[model samples]
Target: MTVSAGSRTLEVKVLSAEGLTVDRKPVTKNVFVEIRAETLNCSTTSLGVADGARGSPSWNETLMVEIPPYARSITFDVKCKTSMGTKSVGIARIALSDFLGGIVPESSLQFLSYRLRNWEGRRNGIINFSVRVKSAMAPKYEPSVPVPMPALADRGSCGSQMRVPSGEQHNPRGVVTGIPVWWTNHSANP
Candidate 1:
C-alpha cells in the first residue's frame, strides 16, 4: 500500500517478547502481536514460536505500516489464544521519538525494547523490536516575516523605506503627508 498524504511509512520488525504471563503461567502457543498506530485497522504477525517455554515468544516478523500525520507512538498488543478464546496478554506503547525524531536518519535501523503493561496496567513483559523510517516529509510552511508599510512622503513620489522605532511612528523629515503607502501581492490592487 502507498503512504497517504502527510503520513509516514514505518518498517517495524517485531522480534520477540520476554517474561509474558497471563495467570502466573507461561503462555505456550497461539501467540500473536497486533501492530498498529492509533487506528482501528492493524497488521498482525504470524503465531510465535510454539516451544513450551512460551513465556518468551519469538515472532521475528516485519510489517510496513503508514503512521498518521499526528501519530507520535505505536502500539503492540500481545494476545494469547486459550480454549475459551483470545485473551490480552500485554501491551506496549512505544514512542516514535527514538527513531523518528532528533538526529536519527531516515534509513537507519533502530533496535529497541519496551516494557509491556497488562490490561489492568500491571508490569507484564518486555517486547523487543526494530523500527526504521522509510520516508520523511518537509515542513509545509516557513515562518512568515512581517513587513511594515512605508509612510508616504508626498503624492507624486511615495518613497523611502524607514524603520519605525518601537512604540513610535515613523516621522518623515521636513514634512509628512497623510497618503498611505501600501504593499500587497494582489494583482488587482495597485
Candidate 2:
C-alpha cells in the first residue's frame, strides 16, 4: 500500500469488552483484538484473561497505529483462540466522524464504545476504547526559542519592540514625488 508522508498517528487504547459471545457461548481464553485503518498495518492487543473472570474479557492495552489522513474509519476485529484454531468473535467499525469530527481539536482524547457484529452481522458485544490524534503531520509555526533580530531591537532597551529612527528628515522643499516609495538598505547608501 502507498503510505503518505503526512499520515497521522493514532493512540488507540483497547480498554475492555462486554457481552461478547461466539456460537451462542461466552468467550473464554486468548481473546485479543486487531485494529485496522483501511488497509494500513494492523495492531493487535495482548490476549485477555482465560478463566472468563469479571463476566467479560478485558484488555487494557494501548496500541499505536498510523493511519492515512484520508482514512474514514477504523475496524476493531475481536477474535479468540480455540483448541481447533483462531475463531472470529466479532467486528466493530468506528467512523472517523464519531470522534475526529466536529470541533474536536487534535491531540484531544475521545472515549467511545462501539457495537461488535458477529460473522452473520448480528450484535454480539461492545468494545470500549479511547483514541487521540497524537499530532498533525505538519508541525505548527510556533517557534520554541525566541529568534534574535539584533538590527530590529535596540540594545539600550530590554523590551522586544522594534527600534525607531531618532528623528524624521523632511525633504528639502517638502516636495512630493510620483515615484512609489520603495525599500532600500541603509547600509548601501554609504
Candidate 3:
C-alpha cells in the first residue's frame, strides 16, 4: 500500500497584491496557496525529494510576507515547514536596481568584466542545503587608452625614468618605505 499522490509534484510559488508594488515599497501580503495532491496517498510522508522542493504535505495556508521596496532591495528569511519539520526560505526583494544590477550587456567587455572567481560554499545549519550563485561583474577599463607614448617627442632624445627621492631615509626595519608611486596611491598599500 504505497499511497502515492499520483503523478504529484509540490510547486512552491509566491503571489501578492500585485506582482509589484506602486510606491516602490515592500508590499505585504497574505500569501495563498492551493495544494493539488495527485499521487501520494494518505500514509506517505512528505520527507524530501528534489532540490527547492518543500518536502511536506499539501495544505491551503496563508503566509505573511514583507516584499521589500526596490529602493531598499533586500533578502529576508521565511520559515516554512511541512507536517515534518521547519525549513528556512529566503525571499528576495527586487526593484529597478536589482533588475539593472543583474542585466549584463552582450559584449566582449561584459565577458571580461564579470567572471567567476571562487566559491566559498553555502551556510552551515540544520537546513544547510542551499546554493549561492556567486558571481562578480565589473566595468572593464580599456587598458588606460595606451597613452600613445606622445609620439616620442624628439625620437633621438632620451626619456625620463621616475626616481625615488634619494634624501628620504627609508625605515627598512620598522615600516616599509619607498613603495612605488602607483602602489602608494592605493589605500591598502599604506
Candidate 4:
C-alpha cells in the first residue's frame, strides 16, 4: 500500500536513564538501550553501550524514525549486558498521541519522562527523552479510472480443446477417461 503524503516522521532523542535497579541492586554501569516502534519498519539507537560515568549513564542519542499515519506507539527496551547474558532492566511504551495531540506545533521539540517497568511488572527506573513530529506535505488527490480487461477465448467443447499425446482422453468435465500413463506402463511391464 502506498503511504500518503500526510504521513509524519518522528525525531526521538534518548537523553539519559536514572534510578535503575536489577535484582534489587542499583545498576550503575554496563547498560544499553534498545528502541523499537509498533510498526516493523523503524527502530534505532546509539551504536555502543553507554558506560556510566561516576555511576550515571548518559546516552544523549538522537534517532529519526518514520512514523506512518497508522502507527500508535514506540517501545524502549533497556537491557544490561553481563558475563552470563543480557538482562532486561525495564521497558517503556510511548504513545504517538503524546507528541501528535494537536496541541503542539509540528517540528517542535518536547521533553518528557516515563516510568520504566521491569519483567515482573515492578517499577525499575525512569527514562528521559524528547520527541518531535516532522511536518508533512498536504496530500494530492487524483482521479482514478479503471482499465478494462481483455476477453478470453471460448472453448465450446472439451473434445475441441488441446489434448496431450498418448491414449488419455478428457471428458466434458475435464477428467481423464483412460488409465494414467504410469499405470499403463506398470501393467505392460508386469
- Candidate topping lDDT: 1
Question: Runs in model 1 with CA error above 4 Å?
Answer: 51-55, 146-190
What TM-score does each of the candidates earn?
0.70, 0.67, 0.17, 0.63
In model 2, the worst 10-residue window by lDDT is 166-175
Off by over 4 Å in 3: 1-70, 76-79, 82-98, 101-190
Top TM-score hit: 1
Model 2 Cα shift for residue 174 (angstroms): 51
After the best TM-score superposition of candidate 2, give how far the Cα of residue 70 lies from its true spot, in angstroms. Answer: 3.0
lDDT of 4 by residue, 32-105 (tens): 77776666664545433445464645678887776665567888888887789989899998877777755687
Q: lDDT of model 2 at residue 125? A: 89
Q: Order the candidates by TM-score, highest first — what do you get?
A: 1, 2, 4, 3
Q: What does the lDDT come to for candidate 3?
A: 0.24
Task: Give the alpha-carbon lDDT of every model.
Answer: 0.75, 0.73, 0.24, 0.66
lDDT head-to-head 2 vs 3, winner: 2
In candidate 1, what residue range of length 10 has the lowest lDDT sum? 167-176
lDDT of 2: 0.73
**Could you give candidate 3's per-residue lDDT for residues 131-167 as a string of tens digits?**
1112222222222221223544334433333333322
Deviation in Å, model 1, residue 20 alpha carbon = 0.6
Instruction: Write candidate 2's Cα lDDT for 138-178 as tens digits.
Output: 32222233334455222332333222222224221122223
